[model samples]
Target: MQFADAKERVLSLHQQLQEHNTRYYVLDDPIISDAEYDRLMQELIQLETSFPELQTADSPTQRVGAEPLPFFEKVEHTSRMLSLSNAFNREDLMEFDQRIKKATGLDQITYVCELKIDGLAVSIRYQDGIYSLGATRGDGQIGENITQNVKTIRSLPLKLATPINLEVRGEAYLPKKEFERINKQRADNGEPLFANPRNAAAGSLRQLDPKLAAQRALDLFIYGMDGSSEVYTTHQETFRAIKKLGLKVNPEWKVATSIDEVWEYIEHWQLERSKLGYEIDGIVIKVDDYALRTKLGFTAKSPRWAIAYKFPAEEAISILEDIELRVGRTGVITPTAILKPVVLAGTTVKRASLHNEDIIREKGLLLGDHVVVKKAGDIIPEVVSVITKERTGEEVAFHMPTHCPECNSELVRLEGEVALRCINPACAAQIREGIIHFVSRGAMNIERLGEKVVILLYEHKLVSSVADLYYLQKEDLLALPRMGEKSVDNILSSIEKSKGNSLERLLFGLGIRFVGSKGAKMIAEHFGTMDAIVHASEEDLLAVEEVGPKMATSIVTYFKKPEVKELLSRLQGANVNMTYKGPKIVHANDSDHRFAGKVFVITGTLESMSRQEAAEKLEQLGAKVSNSVSKKTDFLLAGEKAGSKLKKAQELGVTILDETAFLAEIER
Candidate 1:
C-alpha cells in the first residue's frame, strides 16, 4: 500500500479506537463486542508497526508503555488543589449558612451540593480538546504526573466536545462492586486486602504500570474544571458544561437557596449514599455563584465558600454469635466478634473487630448478647456497645485466649500497647498472616492464590514462605481438594505475573513491623531497589523523609534476620523485579510556621476555610492533624455545631479555639 494511503488509514483507525474506548470505558456502553474491538486494535497495531512514523502517544496500544519509569516527574499545578473542611451535622450546615451570609452580607445564600466521593483527587489537563496531563494532588501546589494511568480510565475523555483548553478535577474511585471483586481476589490469593474502595483506587492510580491501573476497572466523576479561557456563571452551569464535554459527572446534586434546603439535600443523600455504586463519605456544599466563590476567596488549603457535610457514623443492632481470636503477622491476638448476619450501611456484617480484651471488658461484651455495631468511616465494623439490659442469663462472658490460637504460644501484653502479642516469630499463625499480607492488593497482589488456597498449600507443605510461592508447581496445586486444572493454571499465571511488580509492593508485602504502604513506596523510591534497601544502614533510612527512629530500627532489624536475607536471595534468584517504579517523594525543607509542632483537631464548621483547608494550613505550619480529639491534642479548632469531639476535647482539657482565634493564631 502507498504511504499516503497508509497514513489516512492509520488516522481513521486512531479515531475509531479512541471513540470505541470512550464508549466502552467512559460511557460503559459499547456498540461493538470485545472481539470486534480487539480486531480493530490489532489492525491499528499492524498499521502503526508498518508505518512507525504515524504512531502517537494517544494510540490505544500505548496504554502499556515499553518499560516502567524509575520515578514520576513532579508537575506543579496551575492552581492549588485545595481540601474541603467538614460539617458533621445539621447544625454545622446551618452554621455554614450563617458564615456565608456574614461574608456576603446577604441574609440568604444559595449552595450547590455534590457528593463527596470517597476516592483519590486528580486533575486532568486538556489542550485544544485532547488530553495532555493528569496529576495527583500532592501537597496542593505540586503533584506527581500520572498521565498514562489516567488515560486508562475510560470514563475520562481523551478528546473533548469542543476544541478548548481545560483542566478538569475529579475523584477517581473503584465502584463498590469492583472494590469487592478486587478484595475478594486479593483474599483468594492470600494477599493483604484493600481496606476500602478509596484505598484500592489510590493504590491502583499509583501503579507504575498503566496496564495494571487499567485492569483495576476504575471509574471517574468529573466535578469541576480549571482554566482561564472559559467562564461559567454558576456551579450548576459548570456541571452541565462538563457533561456536555463528554465527561462523567454524578447526577444526584442539588442547588439549595436556603439552609433548610441544604439540610434537605444532605438528608436525602445520607440515605441515598448507600444506594450509589461508589462510596460517598459526605456532601460538598459550595456557593452556587462563581462570582461569590471568587469574592469569598480561598484559604491556604480550601475555598472558604465550600464545606463538606460528612455523614455521621452508621450503626446497626446485631446478635453476637461468638468471639474468635485471630493472630496477626505481628502475632497480636485480636478478639473478633462473630455476629448474626446483619446489614450495616450497604454491606453485610458477619464480623466486627472486638479490638482487644480491654475493649471487650469495657463494653461488657458477652457471647450471644445483643450489641450495637457501627462502621467507622463506613469501612471497619466494630462493636459500639453491648445491649446489656436486653441480655439474658444464657449469655456467656467473653474471655481472652491465654495462648495463640494458631501456635499455642503464650500471649503477653506489651509494656504500653493495648494489644496482647505472641512474641514467637516462627508461630504458624504469624507466618500465615505474613504471607497473606505479602500477597495483598496493596502488596504484590498475586491473584487467585487466596486464603483457603494458602492454608491448603501450607497444610500440604507445598508452600510455606513467600518465596516458596515462586517455586510452586502445577501438579502440586492440582493435588489439592477441588483444585481444577483451570484454577491451578490461573494461580500459576498470576504468581508469574507478580514477579514483575516493583519493589514497593514486595516491600509492603514483606510486612515489616511499623512500615505501611506509603512508607514502603517512599523507601523503595529513595533506595531505588531492594538491594539498595537491604544494604541501607539505619542512618541511611533515617535520612529518608517520613522515616522515624522506630521505623528505621524496624527496617534494619528485619533485614538483618538470616531468614529474611535468604528469602530475598530466593526472590532474586526467581527473577522478581526489585527496583522502585513510581515518583520519588521530594524532600522539601519545612519552613518554621507559627503552628509548628502542635497537634490540632478541627471540628464543627469554620467560616474562614473548609476543615481540610484549616488542617492543611496547620500541617503547613508543622502541626500534626488528627481526626479525633485526645489528651495529646494541643488545640481543638471548634466552629458552630461542634459535637462529641468538642465535648471530648473539653473533658480531656484540650484547648479550644474559635474560627476567629484560629485565623488570628495562624496569621500571627
Candidate 2:
C-alpha cells in the first residue's frame, strides 16, 4: 500500500477502535466480538509498526505503551484532590448525613453512591478532547507522569468525541478474569502471585514501562472530574458526562435522594459486590448537588460532601480437622489449618494460614475444634478464633513442628524469633517454592512460569534450583504434560529475559527472610554488588536502615550457604545483573524550601505520575512523604477521587496542592 493510503487506513482504523472501545467500556454494548476487535487492533499495530513515522500519540495503538522513562517528572494539579471520610456502618452514615444537614440547614440531601473500587486511583487530563496525561495521586500535590501507561488501558479513551480540556479521575483495576489469567501465568512461570486484584492493579499501574502495564490488562471506571469544562454540573451529572465523553463509569452508581436510600444502596452492594468482575472494599457516597458540595466545603484532608461505607468482614464457622506444617522457600515453617469445608466471602475454605507458631498458640487452636473463619481483605481465609466451648475433650493440642514436613530435616528457631525454620537448603519443597519466588512478577518477573510448571520441572528432575530454570531447554519443557511447542518457547524466552533483571530484583527473588522489594532495593543500593552483600558480616549488614539484627543475621547466613554460592555462580554465568544501579533519584539543593520542609500525603491516582516515583522525587527534595494523612502532614497532594488521607489532611488544615500546582512547585 502507498504511504498516504496506509496512513489514512490507520487513522480510520483508530477512529473505529475508539468508537468500539467507547461502546464496550463506557456503554457495555459491544458491536464486535473480542476476537474481532483484537484482530482489527493487531492489523492497526502491524501497519503502525511498518510506518513508524505515521504513528501519533493519540493513535489507538499508542495506548499499549511507549518507552521506559528514566524517571517520572512531577506535575502539580490545578485543583486539590480531596478524599472522603469513612462511614463504617449505618450509624456512621447517619452521622455523616446529620452533619451535612446541620451544616447546610436542609432536611434532606441527595447523594451519588459509587462502589469503593479496590484499585489504584489515577487522574487523567484531556486537552482539546485528546487524552494528554495520566498520573497517580502522589502527595495530592505532585504525581508521577504515567500517560503512556494509562493509554494502555482499553477502557481509557485516548480522544473524546468532543473537544474539551478537563481532568477526569477514576479507579484503574484489573478485572477478575484478567487477574486470574495474569496470576495463572505468573504461577506457571514459578513466580509469586499478587494476593488480590487490587494489589495487581496498583503494581501494574506503577510500572515504569507502559508495555508491561499493557500486558496486565487493566481497566478503568471514571467516577469524578477535577474541574468544570463544557461537561456537567453535579456529581450525578459528572457520571453521565464521563460516559458521554466515551469513558467508562461505574455501572453500579446511583443517585440517592436521602441518606436512608444511600444506606440501602450500600447495604445491597455489601452483599452483592462479590458478583461483580472487580473487587470493591466499600461504597462511596457523594453529595449529588455539585454546588451544595462546594458550599459544604472540605476539611483539611477529606471533603464533607462524601463518605465511604466499608463492608463488615464476612465470617463463618468451620471445624479445624488438623494443623499441618508447610515449609516456605525461606525454610520458615507456616502452620496451615486443615478445615472442614465452609464458605467465607465467596469461595469455599479448606485451608487457612495460621501465619506462624505464635498465632497458633495465641488463638489456643486445637485439632477437632470449631473455629471462626474470615477472609482478610476479602481474599485470604484466616482462622480468626477457636470455638473452645465446642471443642471435644478428645481434641489434640497443636505442637509446633520440629522438622521440615517434606524433607524430614531438623528445624531450628532463631533467637528472639517465634518461627521454626528448616535450615535444609536442598529440601525439595523449599527448592520448588524458591524457584516460584525467584520468577515472581515482583522479582525476576519471568512470565508463563507458574506453580504447575515448577512442580512438573521438579517432578521430572528438570529443575533442582532457581538456577536450573535458566538452563531448561525447549524440548525439556515441552516434555511436560499439556505443554505445547509455543508455550515452551514462550516460557523459555521469558526465562531468558529474566536473567537481565536488576540487582534489587535479584535480591528480592533470592527469597531472603524478611527482605521485600523495598528492602531488596535498599540492600542492593547500599552494598552495590551481590558479591559484596554475600561477603558482608552481620554487623556490616546491620548498618543499613530498617535492617535489624535478625534480618542482618538472616542475610549474612543465607549468603554463607554453599547452595546459595553455587546458585549465585550459576546466575553470574547466566549474565544476570548483580550490581545495583537503583532507580533515578531527583534531588533539590534548597533544603528548607516550602515543599522541602513539608510532609505531604497522597492517596489515589494523579493524571501524570506513579505514586512511588512521586514519593521518591519528594524525598529527594527533602520532603517527607507519609502513607496516611495526619496532623504532622504539611500538605495533602490529592488527585482525582482521593480517599481517607485527603479527609485527614483537610481536617488537619494541611495545605492541599493539585497535580499542576505540584509540578510547577517541583520544577521551580
Candidate 3:
C-alpha cells in the first residue's frame, strides 16, 4: 500500500479501536465481537509496522505497552491527593454534615455521594488534549511515574475531546471477574494468590514491565479535576465535563439535597455495592457546589468538604448445628462451629472457627444457638457473637474434648498458652495436616496438590510424613482413585519443582510453633543454611533480630524433636534447598547503613508498596522488621490513616517515620 493509504488506514483503525473500547469498557455495550476488535487491533499493528511514520504516541497500538522500564521516575502531583477522613456510622455522618453546615453557614447543603472504589488512587495529566503523564499518589505530593502502564488502560482515551490542559484523578482497579480469572491462573501455577482485587490492581500497576499491567485488564474511573476552576461550577458538572472529554466516570453517583438524602444513598449502596463489577469499600460524600468547597476548605490532611462513610463488615445470622474439633499440624486443637448454610459476604459459609475454648466460654456459645457470622476481611469466616436473644432451652453448651479427636490422645494446654495442644507425635491428623501445610501456597507451593489428595494419600498409607511427599512414586499415585496419568504427572512435576524452594518456605511448612514466615526468613538469612539453624542453640537463635525469647525457645524446642530431625534428614536426602536464596543479607555493623540493626514495624495504607514488600526491603538492609509495635521496635513506619500501631509506637517511645522518610532510608 502507498504511504498516504497506510496513514489513512492507521487513523481509521485508531478511531475504530477507541470507539469499540469506549463502548465495551465504559458503556458496557459492545456492537462487535471480541474477535472483530482483535482483528482491527492486528490491522493497526500491521499498518504501524509497515509505515512507522504513520504511528503516533496517541495511536491505539500504544495500548499494548512500550519497552520495560528500569525504574519508575518520581513525578510531583499538581495537587496533593490527600486521603479522606472516614465515618463509620450515621452519627459520624451527622457530625460531618453539621461541621460542614457550621463552616458554610447553611442549614441544608447539597452533596454528591460517589462509591468509594477499593482501588489504587492515581492521577493522569493531559496537555493540549493528549494524555501526557500518569502517577500514583505517593506521599500525597510526589508519586511514581507510571505513564506507560496508564496508557495501557484502553478505557483511558489517549486524546481528549477538546484541547484542554488539565489533570484528572481516578481509582485504577481490576474488575472482580478479572481478578478471579487472574488469581485462578496464578493458583494453577502455584503462585501466591492476591489477597484482594485492590491488591491485585496495585501489584499489576507496579509491574516493571508495562506489558504485564496491560495483560491484567485494568480499568480506571475518572472522578475529579486536580484544581478548582470556573470551567465547572459544581462537582457533578465536572463529571459531565470529564465524560464529555471521553473519560470514563462511574455512573452510580447521586446528588443529595440534604444529609438525610446522603444517608439514604449510603444505605442503598451498603447493601448493593457487592453486586457491582468492581469493589466498593464505602461511599464518599462531597460538597457538590465548587464555591461551597472553596469556602469549606482543606484540613491538614484531607478536605473538610468531604467525608468517606465506610461500610461495616457484612454479617449474617446462622444457626449453629454443632461444634467440631480440628487438629492443626502443630497439634493445636481448635474448635470449629458448623452452622446451617448461610450466604455471607458473597459466599455460603457452613463452618466458622470458634477459635478456642476461651472464646467459646466468653461468648457463651452453644450448639443450636443463632450466631452472627462474618468474614474477617475475606480471609476467614468466624463466628462473631452468639445471638443470646434467639436461644432456646435445647441449646447445648460446648466443652473442649479431653482427648484428641483423631488419635484419642489426651490434649494438654501448655504453659502460658491458651491453645489446647495434642502432644502425640504419631497422631494421624497431625501428619495429614503437616503434609497439607508443607505443599500450601505460601509454603513449598506444590500446585494441584489440594487437601483432599493429601487426605487420600494419608488414608491409603501412601504418605505418612511431609518428607514422603518428595519421594512419591508415580506407580503409587496412579493406583489412587481419581488419579489420572496426566494428574499424577503434573503433581510429580510440582513436587520436583518444590525441591528448590527457599529455606524460609521449608521452615514455615514444618509448622514450627511461633515461627512465622517472616521469622523463618530472618532465621534462614542470619544462619545462611538449614544445618546452622538446626544445630543453633537458643543463644545463637537470639542473635537474629525479630526473634523474641518465646520464639527462640520454640525454635530450639522444635529442632530438638527426633522426628523433626529425621524429617529434615529425609528432606536433605531428597535435595531440597537448605539455605536462604533471597537478597544477600547485609551486615548491621556496616558503617553507611543507619537503619541497620534497628527494629522497624509498618502500619496503614502505603501508596508505593505493600507491607510485605517494605518488610523484604528492610530485611535486605539488615534491619529487623516486626509486625507489632513493642519496646524493642526502633522505628514505626506509619502511612495514611495509621491506627493502633502508630499510637502504640508513640506510647512506647518508638520513633516514627512517614512514607517519605521510610523511602529515603531504604533508597539510601
All candidates: CA RMSD (Å): 15.0, 12.0, 8.8
Which candidate number would show the highest lDDT if scored against the true structure?
Answer: 3
- Residue 45 in model 2: shift from native, Å? 4.8
Q: Give the count of colliding residue pairs in each prediction.
A: 14, 55, 0
CA lDDT for candidate 3: 0.86
| Candidate 3 local lDDT, residue 299 | 70
Q: Write model 1 residue lDDT over 236-318, tens digit each, in one string.
A: 88999998888888878888889898888888888877789889888898898887887788764467898888777878999
List candidate 3 stretches off by more than 4 Å.
32-39, 187-192, 316-364, 368-370, 378-381, 387-395, 400-600, 603-663, 666-668
Number of the top candidate by TM-score? 3
On lDDT, who's better, 1 or 2? 1
Ranking by lDDT: 3, 1, 2
lDDT of 2 by residue, 1-668 (tens): 88999989998998999899888876778999999999999999899889999888788777764788766667777676666667777888889999999989999898888898888778899899999999876656656688877888888888887898989888899999998899899989999877668778877876778888888888998888877523456776777777887888888889889988887898788778779988888898888887787788887677888888877677899999988877788788888899999966545789998899899889988889999998854346888998888966998888886678899999898888788988887888889998888888778888889888888889999989888887888778777899999898899889888877779899999888888775677688778899899889988888875588878988987888787888899988888889986653223344755677567887778879977667767866767677766668787777654544654554355776767677888887
Each prediction's TM-score versus the true structure: 0.57, 0.57, 0.63
The candidate 2 region of ten consecutive residues with least summed lDDT is 583-592
Cα lDDT for residue 440, candidate 2: 81
Local accuracy of candidate 3 as per-residue lDDT tens digits, 172-198: 999999999998999899998776787
